[model samples]
Target: MPAFALEAEQRKWCEELRTLAARELRPLADAGEEGRINRELLAALGELGLLGRLFAPDGRPASALDLCLLRESLAYSCTEAETALALQGLGAGPVALAGTDGQRARWLTEVTAGRAVAAFALSEPGAGSDAAALALDAEPDGKGAGHGWRLTGSKTWISNAPHADVFTVFARTVKGAGSRGVTAFLVPAGRPGLGGEPLEMLSPHPVGTVTFDGVPVTRDDLLGEVDGGFGVAMRTLNLFRPSVGAFATGMAQAALDAAVEHAGTRRAFGGTLRDLQSVSHQLAETATRVEAARLLVYAAAAAYDRGEPDIPRRAAMAKLLATETAQQAVDAAVQIHGAAALQRGHLLEHLYREVRAPRIYEGASEVQRSIIAKELYS
Candidate 1:
């Protein structure tokens, strides 16, 4: 695909996704309880074969471009669906990337089919952005060489937590080793001593806190080499970061479209809102910013697809700019829509709430800037 323009097939696929989200996913999302996982939406995605696209059944890693397209297209019409798809990819990414054949066969298929929910358990009470500072302790169970570890700690701000059928949990294995000490574990939800509670959040997504009380895992639960989980987490983030930007871009575009339509139709000062120079210029600027952000997101996704070495910097730049731009675009859209935008159930109102969280989650804008600077210096 071109950096600036999607190919014909890509555009057609995006259109299909948009249609599916609007016609099928949006209803399920609307019927879903806020702050909870929508299993019906997941099942719909699975039925559409959209979930299967997140990872290759042939064992190849999912394409970054494909992921971005899926997110952007779905987000344009149904953010809940987009989030469900992204969470599946984010949580099960490590398994697809480096899990043993048994692990992949067991979890990945179920995840794709929406028969099982997955959660990425990396953040803790003290370790939001500083993932390496995670305090989840995983002590050896002392069952000899092939024995499993005992996990005992708490993980908060975990997406799809408590309710998810499985979790890719990160725990500290080596004392005082920092990043190198962290190891990834695949823990099934019903294990003894594993429990969690839902956390009500500004974004209407399934987020919660999970507690591990001497949770035991066997060798089969390990993801990748022990004490090498940091790489696994980083790899998944790097792959998904650009798609995060794509998600933001889609929201921005939706807001822009809303603003444009409202401006053309709503009369103000004896004319339509679009007749005002201020409104027109603001919309123009917002549209331009959205387009630029979209380009950056596409470029970053393309770079990742090409296996470029500068993906860290590119992905950071894309996510930072796109998320910030989305916030701006959504705000401007609300502003242009005036009091109606703030009313309950308004599209702009929903977007206003949705746009703020992306800048904070995945990686904060400050964190993205830090990544870009670090990549530059390195």
Candidate 2:
């Protein structure tokens, strides 16, 4: 809230997390989207406390400033794998922030500990930026005994869906349709009639369509109040959307790093590529952008962690800068590497795809601008 910056403890955690991810997770980063995540990788992150950051020290952020730093570091090493790890916190954040104690102990604890994976099921074929347009339904059963409702309808483009053991799902509870009718649910995986099919997207992290048909849910499973999840989900996004920006900063930094290395080593016209003002200037500009974006994301993340009042505007700016900078940085890296950069097995190629998805997810870049403008105008 008051110009948040890194502390020694946050810096220490970032150093340790980067070492672990660079050692264990970075090597497996570009195994194609299908092979991106696994139990071993999850376990590795859990052991390093990547997943535990939100819950490890009394269920608050381990460090207000480290959220962006850790995510940036992880993204630099491996964005896809790192994002899956990061979402464990974001995906389950509504529960961590507002769940019933029972719900917290049941789903939140396990997800933080990496014993299970958590997912967010909010996007649908018809609803994304217009979250209020959600069509998923949660209705009281005709013969309700203990269970309060049954959720039905489909959610698309869900991250961590295939392997996730539970989901923080948003569905309609009141008879009225739209986001106002929505309520968040702590839906357990392997429940009867719950769907876990996968979808083919440009950049992948086990995303797909989740069809909930008469899935039994108890009153305790409802996150926030009836038709109150609109506020709950928005609050959760306010906490995480900046981290998505941090993830972008990490990626763009990676691209800058790649560009630097390539420019220094590769030769052009009987001289090193680094001698080219064009090449050197691009790398310099990208480096500057990465640092600026990283700082913006951190400032927003810390403000959110501190319960700052103007978080929506700051968070929107953070997301906007980080996501857009990541795309430009990766493109610069590709330019430095020429044709080789776009080849398979190249990190930038994968990053090129990975960077695009963040803008679309959390909220589209255009939507973020709209949000910031609306708030500023108001």
Q: List runs of model 2 lying over 4 Å from the truth.
A: 1-5, 27-37, 60-64, 143-147, 175-177
The Cα local distance difference test for each model comes to: 0.92, 0.80
- Give all TM-scores, in the order shown: 0.98, 0.93
Candidate 1 vs. true structure, TM-score:
0.98
Per-residue CA lDDT of candidate 2, range 61-136, in tens?
A: 3544566677877877766558767778877788877787777777766776678888888998899888888888
Q: Can you write out model 1's per-residue Cα lDDT over 1-378, one digit (the tens) per residue?
A: 353678999999999989989998999999999889999999988998999999987644689989999999999999999999999999999999879988888998999999899999998899988888998999999867898899999999999988999999999999889999999999999999999999998888899999999999888899999999999999989999999999999999999999999999999899999999999999999999999999999999888988878888899999999999999999999999999999988888888888898998878999999999998788
RMSD of each: 1.2, 2.2
User: Would you give me the overall lDDT of model 2?
Assistant: 0.80
Please report, as a residue range, the 10-residue window in candidate 1 with the lowest summed lDDT.
56-65
